[model samples]
Target: MSPTPSHSASRLLILITAGFGLALGAQAASHDDEHASGAHGAASSQEEPKVIAKDSLKQKMAAGKAAAKAEKSDPKAEPTSVSMAELRDLIDQKIAEVRAKQAAAPAVKVVNKSPKPRAVAMSGQVKQSMAAYGAAAVPGLPAGHDLHWEYTGTAGPQSWGQLKPEFKTCSSGTRQSPIDIRDGIKVQLEPIQFDYRPTPFRVIDNGHTVQVNLDPGNNITVSGRRYELVQFHFHRPSEERINGRQYDMVAHLVHKDAQGRLAVVAVLLDQGKEHPMVQLVWNSLPLEKEIEQASPVMLDMNLMLPEQRQYYTYMGSLTTPPCTEGVLWLVLKQPATLSPYQLSVFSRLYANNARPVQSASGRMIKEGQ
Candidate 1:
């Protein structure tokens, strides 16, 4: 007998489901066999490890080490891929670049210790000290406290002795300047020789006094020796140690010999008519506030000479502080005349410019006589 259509379909579905179950069962059985084999191998290895003695195990380890060393020693074992030459070139290039960079860098420099700060501080202190004293207290000058232009009162020659310690001659020294020319002693007169020429002139207000610069061509010859005129200036009450006395006004003629010896000739000026030289200096005077340009005008050195060649000679020092010693002093016996106007001009500029007279100290005051 034949089955029905529905029963046939149902039978087909059951067959399909049974085949799928069978396939899954087969795969499980295969996996279990693989796991069992792995477990058996592990257990067998552990059971067999007791076969080796301790010494034998050590020997086996040594043999293994030796085998590793032999493999390392084998020349052809490792592939020769890395090139030593390439590595060395790369290292050398890096070293050269480092050296180049170092050379291009700036060199290290040291600084100098500057002295300007110390010098400025010291100068300030000196100025402060001078201000406190009122008058400038230079070493080796008269000690009078008052400041003057040239002569009289505080600026007079009499006060020089009390101004400073170094100017002791102001009181004690006997050979002083600006002495009155009383009577001329009879002496054989020699013609005064004058050698003057046109030369450049320079004038300066020197802060302390008016200094006239003379060129080298101007000179004076006395007793066959040549005395080069260096410079000439004015002093208030003259500072000449003649027979030990002081005068009203004086002109100092500074001369230097070839050997560098100094000789100063002082010409005393009395209150009288205006002298030609005085007028010349006053006419060319620059405006009070400004320094005028110096002109190359003819100056007659002879005009300042004494009418009577008679003179008093002595050895002395500069009356001014820093009183340089060893000066040959020659005070003319004759006096020059200066008008009140000329004297007033100088007084306007400097009322007390003269240094106080110094002591002669028994120095030999020789007369041409």
Candidate 2:
């Protein structure tokens, strides 16, 4: 049977008291030897007292352990002095009891607190389409070039020349178009023969302007030089100025000859009655920029022209970037009319897309009679 804590304490106390008694007797014997030895033993006596007391306690502890072993062999012997091992076991048992009591107490729950976040779910088709779109958007460059020009920004007309070496003419060219056609020599110039046909067309909002692409068949003749009509586009607040007067908008009919020479016809527009030709083209306005929308019916290019065929002619360069020289420019004298509603539609898309007029540099402009 195991002893209770009170019984363990009593046995420990008896052993400790007997050890003290043994230590005191040894200490007395050492003092007597010190007196006999006199001065020689004085230095040694100071250190010997503690050593002798420690040895006497160790001897008593040994004797106590032997008695504990003998008592254990007997069937009904009660313990007197506790051995060192038995005292160690008693102390360990008390420590275990204290730890057990503490473990029995109620525990507290430590909660983790944080803000909940919103979850976004994306489908597989959406991810695949996005990946394909990124690959197709800018195919040649794969990665779009930073030098892409715009109507108004850091990449606007003013900075076009610096953007790329090919576009340097935008700022440095001498014979740029859309000049203020002022102080020109009025002459009976050779009439421009329009051979326009009712042709199918496609319109695209090409980020910069609403451009119309026509099927090949239409052609225009001027000065015996035949040039086929390719495509045409409009600009707000005409790029060209007539005797210092600026129109509301302008349409540029672009053409190219067999020899690769180019001729452009400028049809100026003002806000008034709605134009059928302009309405036809605007009806097919593409929903997305850079994407083309084909018109259901064919377009008669003649409806795009004014009744009077007289024009102000000049030898100039392209108005937009890479403003190459030697192109024949024929600016119509009569302005076309577009309705206020029609004008508003185009204006919403491009509030201001026209480039500012360039310097004439004393170039000769012909006003046809």
Candidate 3:
């Protein structure tokens, strides 16, 4: 029983590839080396071309890669004289000939005799989630289907919990964030020690808000714990309120400690004078969502804050979905100013992305004296 041409070609190609010490360089001298001053070399050179041509497209790609790598590593190696298009044309011609041979050959019939498997019932969790939201039934469903959630419409915050089982905390959590800072007990509280400095930043319009991710070294120390500043983002019509009054916008500076404990500093924004920090971030806004725009200039975090360090503090959850509680919220009392134009720029992108304030629920809030 003799092997087919395809099988024989594949085995020969494998053997050649395994001992691929010599490179197929671009220099004419390298091509000459293939047919060296020996009977053994001359015989190999004659059979090599036919065997290489019969190989599959995968092997051709591998050979092309090997040639490129050899040329790159060797300074004496000449640049590839052939273009990728020419190489592609040569490969296509060989493929067409192979296809023509197959087309001329007689076809054979083969049938599978395996029986069909039984149907499985859907789980109660997935069934409930799909029934509640009319979502697609797919494997590894967390709660709702893998549908993208939004700030408005059917996929908005109201339907966040029902949309996915994992986001159930968003609706069931008792200590959720962005609560109205009213009736807070005034007391002598430790001032949060800010250790911010000028650092390189990357701006991104992440579908929901304009977030600025900063380099390491910027952090804050409060209540005897030091939390590193991860990133900060802007929300229109501010999520949290001070004495029942909502500001124009808010900057949530999120931080985390070594143990993954979270702390958020809210810098409320109002329409007045132009803000240098806000303008710097807006300057680096990407043309499309999810695309990050890096800035050449460094940003000083101190410019983002107000002169008055007085703040109101409380324990709450994140303003967004999967509202996990235990977050330490520090809302700056004196609101920062951004010009009317600055406010309008953000409004155009996200007019109302702020979540409505949640219940204080007898949570004790501390107002810095």
Candidate 4:
């Protein structure tokens, strides 16, 4: 007896429904194994049915189609429609199980990987600062022979002439600076009329001395000529001597006129009270050698002078290099005062920088009577 069309359809539908139920039951069993292993909690089981419905249904349908194709002996064989609600519920359980496992695992922390700061050496930092200033390698030396001279040792004052031919006058000049101002020819010499005012200044650690370059406003008129104050620098152990006595330090206020002739006023420093102008200059000195540092303060040449108007005058050469001659010198008889602390500040930088006093060589030194 052949079956009716409706009956055949009902049987095929029942088979398809059974197969889908079986696939869903297998997926649920797999999730139950995970639950037993304590990978997922009770809350995961409650949310399982909503997590993975669509993907499970599609997979089950693909499986049914494959089965129908394999059993093609019946000409009317086709895939039966099976509701996916149960299959979805089963897959959702597996998804919930995976999510719960992720929540329970220990979390990983990310650490920062920034680089460490580099250390800088003090000497190297000073070198860099000096390089920025385009500082000359040698201080207190001529441009070409910047690196050749020093206070003592090979290029000391004794060998300065031998260091370079241009410096021959350093050893051979007849009239040199820093002579003992004794037994001077007394005369009614005119007093130096100082026209000094506050001017901008910069200090330089020239390796040989701390030189202060000033703005051209200060002037001194003596012997019928005006000399513009150019610069002033320090030398320890007083360059000039009076009655065979050397003071603590001396400042050579170098000046020049429009004709390019040089004049220097030597102010001898004796250890006594604190000098404000000297303090200002020392405070502004640069840490590195051969570097120039401009001060915020202004200096007056008159502040560095003594109350006495008497001075010993002579014609001489520059105490430093090229040893050029024809410089007019005025050594003030009264010494300016500086504290012991002030003297130490310079002594630390230059233990000794004074040029040895040369023979007067029959030079006529005129004293203001």
Q: How much does candidate 2 score in TM-score?
A: 0.60
Backbone clash numbers for all candidates listed: 27, 0, 3, 0
As for model 1, its CA RMSD to the true structure in angstroms is: 33.7
Residue pairs of candidate 2 with colliding backbone atoms: none
Q: 1-369 in candidate 1: lDDT tens per residue?
A: 233433533443344334433433444455455667665655444432332333344454354345445545776643211122222243345446646655654542212335667776866553332322121223223222333323457745566566666455555555544333333354654544667675555454544555555667888777677888766777776655344566567888777676555577788888887899757666656553223336458667777775776677667765553244566777777878788888888888777776654445556665675
Q: Give every collision pair in model 3.
A: 143-165, 144-163, 144-164
Query: What's the TM-score of each model vs. the native?
Result: 0.49, 0.60, 0.61, 0.61
TM-score of 3: 0.61
Candidate 3's C-alpha lDDT? 0.73
Candidate 2 C-alpha error for residue 33, in Å: 99
Order the numbered candidates by lDDT, best leading.
2, 3, 4, 1
Per-residue C-alpha lDDT of model 4 across residues 1-369, encoded as one tens digit per residue:
233544544454455454445545556655666667565566456544533443555555566455444444455543321222233333455446656655655442211222222223544443322221122323443222254777799889899878777678888888877788788999988899899999998788866788777777999998889998877888999988988999999988877776657788999999999998899899999887665787898887778898896899999877776566788999888899999999999999998989899899889999887
RMSD of each: 33.7, 30.6, 18.9, 23.4
Q: Could you give candidate 2's per-residue lDDT for residues 1-369 as a string of tens digits?
A: 456644755576466555555555556567676676665656554656666656866775566566666756776655433333466455456446645654654432211211211111233322222221121122222211232777799988888778878678889888887799988899998889999999998887766778787888999999999998877888898999988889999999988777656789999999999999999999999887766687998999999999999999989877666566778999999999999999999999998878888899999999999
> Once model 2 is optimally superposed onto the true structure by TM-score, how far is the C-alpha of residue 334 displaced, in angstroms?
0.2
